[model samples]
Target: MRGPHNIIRLIRTGATLERTGAMKVILDAYEAPRLLRMVVRGVVWPFQWLGMKGDTSMPPATRALTALGPAYIKFGQVLSTRPDVVGDELAVQLRVLQDKLPPFPIDVAKDSVRDALDVQVRDVFDEFSEPVAAASIAQVHKARLKETGEEVAVKVLRPGIEKAFQRDVDAFYFAADVIEFLSPASRRLRPRDVIAHFEGVVKGELDLRLESASASEFAANTVGDEGFRLPDVKWAYSGRRVMTMGWAEGVPLGDNDALDAAGHDRTRLGERVLQLFLSHALRDGFFHADMHQGNLKVAANGDIIAYDFGIMGYIDEYTRRVYAEILFGFIQRDYKRVAEVHFEAGYVPADRDVDEFARALRAVGEPIFGMDASHISMGRLLSYLFEVTERFGMETRTELILLQRTMVVVEGVARSLSPQLNIWDVAHPIVEDYIKTSIGPRAVLRDLAKTAAVMARFGPRLPGLVEAALIRQSEIEAPHNRGGHRKMWALMFLGGLVAGSGAVALAVVL
Candidate 1:
């Protein structure tokens, strides 16, 4: 399925774009060169008959992506946030891919719930309504628990979605391979690795149980966070194919009219959204990666309600520290420090000149600083950053893909709420606080404590390890000196252990 057969898939993709009248619009938005546009049209136009004939009422781009399957729909959702890249018209059209796609039949959803929970729908849900929202992987139904009489949202995986996603992912792998082979420049971005990461995330999302667990963990992590909340997971009602959580009542984040009607402060809401995302990413190292407007809402009391925990992002402590340093450097306009941090984290190749790289970074950062959100263009900034990374021999870090992408999407979401929001102003304090906690003397003590705990695990075996080292050293030395060598090695090892233990004690006391 991932072989030459995918050529057919690729052709169908292009043909769908052609037939739906999206090919030209997309090419034009991307500013494709004359020759490239001519070549693309020549290649894709002839096979337009092979394309899927999607709903005629939908916009061209939306219809094409919806007809293609879940993967393309997800792609469209991401593009929806990048109006600067896709153009405002197409971005508006693609917003439907977020949570308003046509849903499966209610009967089918009920059958799925029954099969997953091994109980009749009527027995478990006292009032199960039709799908209130549908997206790429799953749809949500407004329901009431029979036992507790509590309202909940029951999410059921689309029928045959696994096979649908796998098919599209296979085609994506083939396309990535072709891109890498045909264009040497694209290799630095690791197209295939990006697809592999997408595949892993989709697979995790397909299992409702994983989403339920993710929601639970995110809830626990954010319990202390103010003005942010997640719906409680209904564990007993959740399964691989079906998930249930407490119903969230709020106005969608995208509905500015409704938010205003409800007296929610859009500017403050925007700032809070950005701050919450940063806090989760830097402090907890785990965040809701898919934080588009569709997954967010504002309650009557102004608390932001987040639901649909399918795709999440996670960075380790070290990576989080590096990220914080880079951001803090930018906030302070310390381009050299930002460049140094990139090198220290091995994100840029060692051969790259730090001073020159710092200059390149300055080119990227300086333009955006002191500029209002309305003046700055994140899309252009990201494009320039991409070129800089490519020039410096920085390969795509797969672990940070979700984090980076979510940052872009979240920024878009925040801006939608408050068009004049200053992203840098909102982000500075969070990054600064993270840096203070994660990069100083206290951080060193924390690291030392962790190291000591790990070393303590080997404490019982130290004597045996020392004996083995001494014996090996004595064997390597002259036979006559074995006794003296053993004594000397023992003292050195014992002294080192004492010093290490003393340091650990001092750290603990401090």
Candidate 2:
């Protein structure tokens, strides 16, 4: 089923693009190579009749992607933030896919709610209005709780969305296989691993219960963060296919006119958005991965309210330190330190020359430093950074994909609010502060404290463990060797203890 169906799906995907007249438009926007464009056109053109004829009213690219399914729409949403990659005109057209997709019927949504919660809409809500917002995976209905009489947003999964996403993802897996098999150079990017990561994220999104938990955790993490908040998740009303949260009332962050009408300071809002994202990423190690305009809103008091917690990004403490240091290095224009950090983190191959990599990194960081806020493009910088890393034989770090993508999207959102927003200026204090806290003497003491706690827990059992180890070693040796083995083991244990103490002392000195 996968082989035949995936081939058909791939052909139909191309055919749909061709039939909707988007094939050329997309290629031109991406500036695809002449030979590659010709090859793509040749491949998809012949199967035009097999494709779905998307709505003729919308733009070609939008229509084709909408007709494709959820996965394609999600891809379009990501591209909408990258006007530098897809071009402004096409990016504008694709932004409509963010939260403007046609929603499923109210009856279907009600049935889904009922199925998920084992209760009728009337049983839980005093009034469940028609969907107020809709996107690829889910739709939200404005509802009032019957018991509390409080307004809440009820999010319901689109009917059959799981199967649709699974189908498209299967096709994507097949396409990745084909690409890797035909083009060995593409293997470094690990196309299959990319799809697998996408699949894992999407699967988590498909279950509303996970989204509920994510929202809860995010709310807890962001507590007391100034001018930023997440809607409170209504746990009792949440289920696998349905989630409810306190309604967020505000103007959409994308509507500049509305924001201006509300008298919000656009420049301050922009800086706050960027600063908040950095704070969350560096300090909390968890953030709203989808920070695009559609998922963000501006309250009247200028608080940046984020919802749609289906996708969140998390890195461990060590990765967070690495990320903070990289940002700090770039801000200081110390390309050599940046290159060293990459190698230290094993991001670049050990065999690569550190000096040469530093030179390449300088080529990337230097050009963007002196540019005006409006002139600098984070998206372009990231694209160039990718090229440099690839040349240096750095493999794609799957864990960082969400963080990087969210950064680009958050930058776009901030720029929309303030065209002259200086990203580096806003990010500097946050990154520098994080470095001072996480990597300095305080951090060393914290690590030592944690280590001491672990050692303390195991302290009581040390003698018995050492005795058991000696007995086991003596059993493995001969009777004649017992005395010599015990003396050697005692010396080795003492040496280890001395080494451990010396290492701790060295850590303190450093």
What number of clashing residue pairs does each candidate have, in the order they appear? 0, 0
Best candidate, TM-score-wise? 2
Q: Write the per-residue lDDT of candidate 2 for residues 34-111, one digit (tens) a residue.
A: 666677778888889988887898889989998887789886765554453466678778867634578999999999
lDDT of 1 at 322: 89
**Highest lDDT against the true fold, candidate:** 2
**C-alpha lDDT of residue 395 in model 1:** 65
Kindly report which residue stretches of model 2 are placed more than 4 angstroms away from their true locations once superposed. 21-44, 55-62, 75-99, 377-380, 461-510
Error of 2 at 181 (Å): 3.5
Q: Which residue pairs does candidate 2 place in steric collision?
A: none
lDDT of 1 by residue, 423-444 (tens): 8778888888889889988887
The window of 10 residues in a row where model 1 has the poorest summed lDDT is 375-384
